[model samples]
Structure formats: C-alpha cells, structure tokens
Target: MAAPDKAQQLEEAAKAAEHAAQTAEAAAANASGNAEAATAAAEHARMIADQLAVIASASPISDFVFLLTIFMLAIFVGYYVVWSVTPALHTPLMAVTNAISSVVIVGALIALGADLSQSANSFAPKLFGFLAVALASVNIFGGFLVTQRMLAMYKKKER
Candidate 1:
C-alpha cells in the first residue's frame, strides 16, 4: 500500500512538470512574435525619417516656386470673392478689412520694436517696418471712411 501511494505521488509531480514546460514554450513564442513586430515598426519609422530628410534638403528654387504658386492662387481667389459679393455687403466687408489692417499694424510695430543691439543689419527691418506701418494705417483709415460714407447713405435725410 505504501509503495503504491509513493508511485502515485511521483506520477502527479511529473505531470505538473510537463505542464510547466509547455507554458514556458508558449510564452517564449509570444515574446519572439513581439520582437519581430517591433523590428518592423522601427524600419517603417526609419523610412519616413529618410523621406523627410530629402524634403528638408530641397533647393531654394523649389521653395520659391511653391510660394509663388500659393500667391497666385490667393490672388485669383481674392478677385473672385470680391466680385461675387453683393453691393450692399461692401460696407461690412470694408469694416472687416479695416480690422485686418489693424492686425498688420500690430505686426509692423513688433518688427519696429525689435532689439537693434543684437545685429548691425537692423536698418532694413526698421525701414520695412516703418513702410508697413504707414501703409497699413492708410488702409485702415481709408476703409473706415468708406464704411462710414456707405452707412450714411442708408440713414433718413433731415427735413
């Protein structure tokens, strides 16, 4: 009876060892799959980095061409938009443009106030800033005057 009990205990221990070995094998297989996926992701990131590097090194002429294309598109769009508006909406549009000109004035003032002690080539910034401020001021004042005149036309005349 004692020998039979000892044999049963040995058999249970062996089965448990076998199950543990199988679990370890499965875990190792999962780790290997994860490593392969990580390698693939790293390769994809490297490819994108290479593409961005090429674009960054593009020539100045290409950059200029791209900007010029955008500028031309803007001009055409602006012309169409202005022409498509009804005459009655022009006053509101002028007021909006005046607000935009005020933003330009703010930018000009920032440029004008840049520290001159940092660089000897400060004159160009000052000159351009002054011109921008002057032009934007004129545009704002003119737009307001036009808007005021347009609004006046709609008022009831005095007897």
Candidate 2:
C-alpha cells in the first residue's frame, strides 16, 4: 500500500510539470509574436519619417514657386485694374495711390526703426526699408504733381 501511494504522488508531480511546460511554451510563442509586431511597426514609422524628410528637403523650392506665381498674378491684375479706370477718375486714383504710398512710408519707417541688435541679419531689413522710404517718397511727390496737373486741366481759363 505504501509503494502505491508513492507512485501516485510521483504521477501527480509529473502531470503538474507537464502543464507548466506547456504554459511556458505558449507564453514564449506570444512573446515572439509581439516582438514581430513591434518590428513591423518600427519599420512603418521609419518609412514615414523618410517620406517627411524628403518633403522637408523640397519645401523651400516649392514655397518660392508658390510665391512667384502669386506675384505674377498680382502684376497682371494690377495692370488690368489701372488700364480699366476712366480718364476722369485718374486724379482721384492718383490721390488714393499717394495715400497708399504714405502707408508704405510708415511701414518702411517702422522697419527702419526696428532694433538691429537682436538679429544677425538685420542689415537687409534696414537697407530695404531705406529703399522703400526713398521710392515711396518719390511716388507720393510724383503722384501729387500729377494730380495737380490733372486738376488744372479742369479749371476754367481766365480771359
């Protein structure tokens, strides 16, 4: 009877060991699957990063092209607008343009007054601001002269 009880205990221990081994095998399989998924996810992230890097490298040229297109369109539009105005409205238009030049002068003055110590590239702004002030000043003075001449043409001649 004692020998039979010992054999039964050994059999139960063997069964428990077998169950533990099976559980460990299943856990190992799940871990390997997770590792594969992580590797695929990392590869996908790397591919996206490469695509973004390519776009970033090409961004400046695209931005320049876009701005050039808008500038060309503005030139065409401004030409058409100026050509379409009636002759009688020319004096008023000149006055408006002079006003716009004054606004430009104000902006240029602000730019000129900006602090140069904060930036290494500040000279360009100052130079362009000076040019803008000079050009706008010319535009304002010329526009007023043209307006005066146009108004004079409309005045009654004294006998």
**Per-residue lDDT of 78-102 in model 1, one digit per residue for the tens?**
5655655556567978998999999
**Residue 49 of candidate 1: its Cα lDDT?**
51
Predictions in order: lDDT? 0.78, 0.80
Candidate 1 lDDT (Cα, 0 to 1): 0.78
Return the lDDT, model 2, position 47. 67
Count of backbone clashes for each model? 0, 0
Estimate the TM-score of every prediction.
Answer: 0.58, 0.60
Task: List the candidate 2 regions with Cα displacement exceeding 4 Å.
Answer: 1-62
Predicted structure 2: lDDT: 0.80
Instruction: Output the lDDT of residue 102, model 2.
Output: 100
